[model samples]
Target: MTRPIRFGHQARPTPDDDLDGVARRAEAAGFDVFLIADHVGHGPAPMVALAAAASVTTTIRLGTYVLNADMRNPVQLAWEATTLDQLSNGRFELGLGAGHTPQEWAATGIEFTSARARKAALAERIEIIGRLLDGDSVSVDGAYHRLVDASVPRSHQSRLPILVGGNGAALLGHAGSHADIIGLQGLGRTLADGHEHSVRWTTDHLDAQLGQVRAGAGERIADIEVNVLVQVVDITADAERSLAQVAEMIDDGTTTTDLARIPYVLIGTVDEIAEKVLHCRDHWGITYFAVRALDDFAPVIDRVRQLE
Candidate 1:
């Protein structure tokens, strides 16, 4: 099957004008979904930014690339996510992760823990989020959160897909069980040595995680969807370089990736990017394009539309 493209934006220097402009153009362009990053102190808060993006457009799906669920209070996040779901008319995906950034945790005053503990806590948070979204009033005593009573209004749409992001065994397992969609992430240190091992490792990890998820959800496993991405930094337009980066993602286990498209980040013309997109899709079966660092996403958006 031909992979469909979902454009994600991580434009750090992206101005509000660019944000609205990109959202308007992206909606018109037919790119499947548009995602915003959820970081501590950068850009507009993802939920609010997506709310704004939703106000300007009618159809393009909006989401966080991956929201740090560990940091967000489940009760508050449930309400916030449902609110965004309502505002977006049910076009939102909630991506969650147990990130390793101590700086962010330190900033939030969130307690620090070992990697294993962190992953365990993240799993509980996922369960809480899912239950709350499903209209159950929840009271949980867990390692991380202890809520007395929490619930959300009925989802405006069908079950909002919970997109879980992370690569370790526990993280992947958390996704397989609770998340409707799994965000396969990069686990390699560099992009030069072909991402083959990483991909295979991730695929294997998911297989293991899937077992846990299947056990947890019982009959609900069939309803889940798997989504993945490979992140990029300091993009250049060179086709070989870009291809290498994308290929690395494929090798690492990401069936999809963010296309780096900053003004000077990439070296080639729009035509070259189109060629690269075709190459990635044809060979690697990559279907998603979460854009990186691009100032105005118009050029990249147009290039993506041509594929459809």
Candidate 2:
């Protein structure tokens, strides 16, 4: 099957930067989506920043790349997301995740919970948030969240697209069952000091993770949009050298060959990268890609647009 491809640019806006101009540039650069990351004390708030982007741009879709479920009440988050969808005139896609960063929890004075706890909490929120976004009155007596006779303003879209991002089996399984978009983030393993583990960068590991999502999705797999966040995009004449550098950065005993196979890193000339993206869509059913907002990625966006 030939799946349709969509490109999203993930923008990190500092307080000193021109937010409106950034959104306008993304729309001009042939991007289909503009996404913001949710982090405390690192960048602007995701939904608030997207609201600013929504006011300036007319066509590019605006969204949080993935909001941490541990941070907010589900009912309140549903209201805020629906409101943003209304403000953006149905151009909003909601992305939610089980919280992973320990530093963010420390910074916010929120208790850092185990991965299992976070995933379970996220599952509950997805249920409540999904219903609320659909304009359903909900009353849930759950361990993590409680909602009594709650309903949010209906989203402009009959059902706003929900993107659930994660790497673990349980979390991806939940995403497979509920989300419109399933973001295949590689295994998100972080050290105690907030350093990323290189194991998450391996190709074999990602394939295994996707298998779990497939199993959980079952018959609904054909209806779901699969997405990957491209961590490295190097368009250069010396593709092998770029791959080597990425392999070293990942440092998980991964070879250049293995790096080449991983869909999340695009390292090649425009033609080569474009061909690889199409190959990935054909083989793995991944057509939605999110890359960091950088000048280097412009040609790649143009190339992917041509494929459509």
Candidate 3:
């Protein structure tokens, strides 16, 4: 069965531009969703920025690409999510993640925990957030978070969609069982003290992660929407040359053929990219694709919509 394709554009707002204009453009450009990155230094507060975007756009879905769980208490997050959903009139999707990027924690004076601990914390938080969003008063004395008779304003939607983003097995397993949308990211390996790396671009690595998700999901597997973040979409006539350039940039001694197999890097003309998208949908059941906002990606979005 072929799932309908949904394309999301990730916007990193700068201080100089009009955010409302950006949201309007995304809606006009045939993009299904407008997403914002959550970080302390680089981007604006995702919830605030998305709320502003929500005010200007009517149809486009507004969401955080993935909100780090460590940053906010689940009860507070529930309140903010409910407000955003109400403000957007049910066009908000909550994307949460086990906080990566240690620097963000350091800069904010938040304690940096081990990856395992963070993932465990995220699992508990997801449970708490889901209950609160569903209008159930929750009381939890979890390892990381404690909620005492916490309940939030009900969301506009009957059940606000929860999207969990991760590449590791434990997090993906949790997402499989809980999330409405499962965001497949690169392998959660730390590259540096403050930075992380994802092997998600590789087909084999992705297959392994998908296995974890499937095993964890069990009967609920059929209900989840599998999403991929298209980190690089290079639309060019010379696909080989573009692939080579990208491989060199990655500098992992990866060949062009190897890069061609990676789902995250889509290099080719619009038609070729569309073919690859269809192939992925048919083979992997990945229908949701997100790419960084770029002029080159608009045509690909248009093409994918036609495929849908």
Where does model 3 exceed 4 Å of error? 196-200
lDDT string, candidate 1, 135-199, tens digits: 89999988788898878887787787788767565666556667777665534322343223333
Model 1: residues with Cα > 4 Å off, grouped in runs = 1-5, 10-17, 188-222, 232-238, 241-289, 293-308
Ten contiguous residues minimizing lDDT sum, candidate 3: 193-202
lDDT, candidate 1, at 283: 43
Candidate 1 structure lDDT: 0.65
Off by over 4 Å in 2: none
Instruction: Tell me the deviation in Å of residue 151 in model 3.
Output: 0.6
lDDT of 3 by residue, 58-125 (tens): 99998888999888889999999999999999999999998789888989998998988888899999
The C-alpha local distance difference test score for the whole of candidate 2 amounts to 0.86
Question: What lDDT is reached at residue 137 by model 2?
Answer: 98
Taking all chains together, the TM-score of candidate 2 against the true structure is: 0.96
Residue-level error in angstroms, candidate 1, position 187: 2.9
Provide C-alpha RMSD values for all models, in order: 6.7, 1.5, 1.5
lDDT of 2 by residue, 1-308 (tens): 56679889998888888988988988988888999988887788898899999999999999888999899988889999999999999999999988777888988889999989999999999988999998899999898877789998999999899999887889888888888899876655766666464456676787887788888888998989999998888888899999989888776677889778878888999988988888888778898999884666778778876875
Q: Can you give the lDDT of residue 179 in candidate 3?
A: 88
